[model samples]
Target: MEISVKDLTKKYKDKYALDHVSFSILEPKIYGLLGRNGAGKTTFMEILAGHILATSGEITINNENPFDNQHLIESICLIKEGNNFKRDLSIKNVLCIYSMFYPTWDPDLAEELVKIYGLDKKAKVKTLSKGMESALGIIVGLSSKAPITIFDEPYIGLDAAARRRFYEILLEEYEKEKRIIIFSTHLIDEVSLLFEEILIIQDGRLILREEADVLRHSTCAVTGSIQQVEAFSKDKKVLNKKELAGMMTAFVYCRKEEAVAEGLKAEGIPVQELMIHLTENKGA
Candidate 1:
């Protein structure tokens, strides 16, 4: 399964929500879409899911345009942040309605997920707690078995334990069935380990796309005297920097060899701190 976006653009009023974005997603890997609020991640996902039309350019899944194409649409499922269903319907009725839409819906899996999430099938959607609603969303997403599953902040109302369970179940299902999953979330560090690749959108632009391991390996932290840190960071992309008294610490993002060689000379820096450095720099 391959999803290709070519010169995709989405505009609202005079502002470009997604500016000529292009990327290809190919088979069986989990991708993490990371960005700050209003950074175009949602726009891109909506376009890919065929929920909205792009202002210009094209998006194709398996060489077929996703927009208004029922065949392609059935193979793709998107769980958005606030996917509101009929508030009066019971959870079971909601699942039943969704089951008719997806060709690959798994009834057993949905039942199991309901049990795992501690959701009451007979409970009305309006009466269920916020966390329960999110769990229902998660259950539907996982059981749908769509080739392209896109989750946009699906764990919004989930507590820490519920979120952890969602992650575990997601990975377990992924391993069992090799499917393409694209997830957009602000909780980068919490779910970074599940991503095979990371796609970062910054200010309505595609900033970086790379393998997750490579991304982690490429960034490092250098802490020392202010002068030493400054000298070491020269010509390097310093994602973030801080000073305490006369000492300074810098998070340098560069090629592995470059960061390691420079760090060795300055003093060996720990790799475990790379995510913190990169995330801090991303915010900055």
Candidate 2:
């Protein structure tokens, strides 16, 4: 399903959780919704999933407003930050209830995911560990087979090994089903390879949206002597820079060809590393 958000804004009295955010999501693509904590990713996802109303502006899925629209809501599934399941219900019962709600729910896939995540179907949700709860959320999010599926920090509290398993299964399912998947995660480097496109939000505003590989290739770090670095960075848009003794290093945003043609080597910097540096370094 194609999603269109036009001038979408969400406010909480004095704060704007989503500040006039607008973007369109083409179907059958995996999008990594990235931002620091309180960047409004969850707010945007909540509005998209129809769980909350936007303070202003609009959102449409297949040209229909999703807010309070059951037909549209049924096609969208969101696994948010907290546990929405009844604590007293067993894992199996929770899955059963979800199956009743979503017409496209795949029982086989849910069962397979439960086994894959090492979740005990008969165990009450209240008894499960944090990691197990996350696993359960992922299982339902993936197996629901909703056209527009959003996972907000779905792997929180999971160990490295379990997180890897979730990523693998997510990729496997996407390859077979070709559905839209929007994931909000702080673990960018670990899961970036799975995203076809990336949307970055900062301070409740959309910073940039582009193809993942293209976005990475569009920015690069150049290191050399202070003179050499400064000379090379003269005309480029530098995202960040640093100086150590007489040496200088700069991370700039420019076309790959232009950087190469300028005799500056452009290397692929991991998104997480780049974000950390960008967030910390303030040199213009």
Top model number, TM-score = 2
> Which residue pairs does candidate 1 place in steric collision?
none
Off by over 4 Å in 1: 254-284
- Candidate achieving the largest lDDT: 2
lDDT of 2 by residue, 1-284 (tens): 88999999999999999999888987689999888888898989988998899999998998988989999999999997668688999999999999998998999999888988888889999998888898999988988999988999888789999999889988998999899999888889899999999887877788778898887888887767788878888987787777999887688886657667767666667888666665544441
- Tell me how many residue pairs clash in candidate 1: 0
lDDT of 1 by residue, 32-131 (tens): 8887788899999988898899999988998998999999999988998775578999999999998999999999999999988888889999998888
Q: Lowest summed lDDT over 10 consecutive residues: which window, candidate 2? A: 275-284
For model 2 the TM-score comes to 0.94
